[model samples]
Target: MLPRIFVVVLDGLTAMHPSPRIDRLYLAGTLVATSLLTACAVGPDFTRPTPPTATRYSPESRPDHAAPTMAGDAPSQTLRIGDRISAQWWEQFRSPDLDRLVRRSFQANPTIDAAVASLRQARYNTTAQEGFFFPTIQASYAPSRTKLSGNTGGNSPGIQGNGSVISTVSNTPASQGGTAPFNEAVIYNWHSATLTVGYVPDVFGANRRLVESLQAQSEFQGYQLEAAYLTLASNVVAAAIQEASTRDQIRTVQALIDSSERALKVLREQFRLGYAMRIDVAAQELALAQAQQSLPPLEKQLEQTRDLIRVLAGTTPDQDLNEHFTMASLTLPAELPLSLPSELVSQRPDILSAEAQLHAASAQVGVAIAARIPQFSINSTLGGNASEFSQMFWPSGKLFSLTGNVAQTLFDGGTLKARQRAAEEGLNQAQAMYRSTVLTAFQNVADTLHAIHADAHTHAAAERAVTAARVSFELTEQQYRLGYVSYLTLLTAEQNYQQARLSLIQAQASRLGDSVALFQALGGGWWNRGREQRAEAAPK
Candidate 1:
């Protein structure tokens, strides 16, 4: 039926020709056959790179639980292997402020906005490329006045009188040429209307491959958007944790300064009563000054961390954030979800995005191969041209053309072949990059796991050290007052207590921060939120 329709159209275009009808039918059938030949794509089909075959992320077995510290109320965390991570993973911390801040960042962050815009752009471009699969039809109408010179060979547009041809013409000036037959110019109005149809039959699947490449690129952008969401959320959580940690450090240093000030006062009174040496008072004063000196940096760090939280929440530094973070305000998740090694390949956005890029590269190889083959095109114009608009569609004024073309690069100095080779190399490059992304992803998980494990032990040790140091410092302080120990011993005990207190605070924060890292390295559980939901969250 399609071939018959093509024959009919061809017959209408070439009606003035004395060509046989069978000849037109044969040509149409040949074009139909050519279109049918493009059943397969030219290059290798894409296959997802296999997931990692390893059973675990680390070489050695990980602990079932993190070591809990006795000094703080923070609980030990248990690792739940092959557990499903929630899409709202941050909620595991049970901090409403953190949850609200992360949500706000998702809505207002510029990075997320940029990624959304890129995804939309890619989708639009892919849709545009798909238009090539259909024939392009356009219609136009033109009306114009044209004049032809009489010098060209043609019959004069005048009445023939007697045996001699006589024509009426404008009077010739006597000065220019005494008496000469006047050359008349012909003027007429031409009207034309045409409907042109053009199509490039993808005889080698070039357009199909092109469309496939664009679709893969769009897919890549979608994953990039997911990556952006993951990164922004992770940043917000980490910044919040850092803010909490810095605040705790500041509080600890302030406590140390207060304790030292109290000690300095006691020493001054002892010296005034002639019960203590001036050097002892001077040493206590120096210790107090040192403790006081540490406060400013901690204060500065706290302020900077607050500013970072503000920015991460997509607000100016001058703008105050209503939500403030402190260690007491955050609850470390007791249960940590760990995905299997095989699941990680599909979980991480970077790995998935790399896979999409590889897919696009594979499609590009097909496109390049298709380009080396002969290209086919069919164009037809169904229109009429006449001197008057009323007669434009008359049979005598009908004008039409049907053309089928095949083009091959005969002598391009191997440009086509070189392009094909380049595409193949590009595919290889994508493969390498994909593998690199997978390796990096695995390394991230392994490193985070190790850090979490180490942080727990460090936290427990720091807590014990703080307890021992506090007891020693208190005992030494009383001994110094009772004339049982030197002021240097008291000072040494005080310094040890101060350092231990600070280390305990750091260890607590590390335990929390590394937990965040573990969640992030495990891909933030984005897959729990299906693609459609995530895409809908993007800005329109």
Candidate 2:
């Protein structure tokens, strides 16, 4: 958007008119820029890569087809190709607690604040560098009382006829430079006022390259900020799912303990009749203890998960959060948007960040090469100096000067060439890093797609296990009550049912967790965000 480096150079040429020396500088730049847009930049110019030729993410196009799942549990998720990813991807889960958690995290999170600050800093630096395109103009006033004597120079001011002789004598050296000399040290006021201007035009585009580099860095931080947001939102969703799974585990274990206790009572009644062995009662009691033993850790995990959510949303563990999540509270989206491989490079924050760094490195090579060439500058000072304050601006006592400067490195044991080579190496490194980041991004999306498909199948299996265990437990309960099954057999069925139920809860959570991961992997749809989602801004 700010490709005005050459435009600013033209601005210096047009406004306020250039001197003969300045005209040459402008003419040189205009001639070079007119030949080619990249004439000013010495080293290799940066070109954004074209999208990959492949139309699909996978060879078999894994996500182009719908995933398979069991009928009763989670349904198959169909990839909705060419569907625009929603900026509010998390809201697809339809959990208000999650929505609130993500909202609060964007506002109150310290990580977000730091990223914003970095973005702002980069913005200011870019702005400051842009200003270098214009001349630096300044004004100054200096008043002094100085002693004029035969030692330093000539006569003191106002020493002759009514300021007339003093003015004439000051402008002319006293006849042969020896006629008049100060007999004694006398103080006189010397007033001077200056209006000056200076400009260092971007003739070779070194400064402009610097500005380009800074703009890329600013964009880099913007992507980084987006990455922070994506990460925080994903973490909150994952933590919420974990909490729900932990709660289900605790609930299931409690139910299991209750079942074991009831079975133990029935066995005790049988023991009095000598129909049940003491070992049978002991087995039931041990089952009860084992189920109870599972409770504390699951409870601990639930509490810890809640605490994690609180911290993610920028609240202390002690702070009360009224919202609680359950498997029922969240809804899995039936359709997921899959970004094509060609578009993924632009959409992914990490990929874009790496690309921005690469752009900056490309600019750096220009800057280093320009440093080896001759640099030009123009300076002018228009001012006046007089013994009287009122006369400082008058034409009779005015002073003015103008100068053009050129600097070129003669030799530094090849230091400038070495730096240019080093910059080229750095560009190479950034290119490699950018390629790595893109590969990683593709892997992330592919892995998430596979996980979603696998999770649905896993949940399906778990659902079947849960159903079978539940039916077996019911049959065993009836048989034990009728003295058809031993207490130990009933306890075994009960434990199996409990484990199955726990697995089902975890599998259900996995489906939800996988959905969050998919949304993150698809770049969190940050491109649609038109403004900051919260009231936070970078500190000035």
RMSD in order of candidates: 5.3, 6.6
Worst 10 residues of 1 by lDDT: 157-166
lDDT per residue (tens digit) for residues 492-533 in model 2: 798799889888888888888888888898898998766434
Residue ranges of candidate 2 with Cα displaced over 4 Å: 1-39, 59-73, 148-150, 155-183, 261-289, 481-483, 486-488, 530-540
List runs of model 1 lying over 4 Å from the truth. 1-24, 61-74, 153-181, 269-282, 469-498, 531-540
Error of 1 at 358 (Å): 0.7
Tell me the deviation in Å of residue 468 in model 1.
3.1
What is candidate 2's CA lDDT for residue 268? 90
Q: CA lDDT of 378 in candidate 2?
A: 63
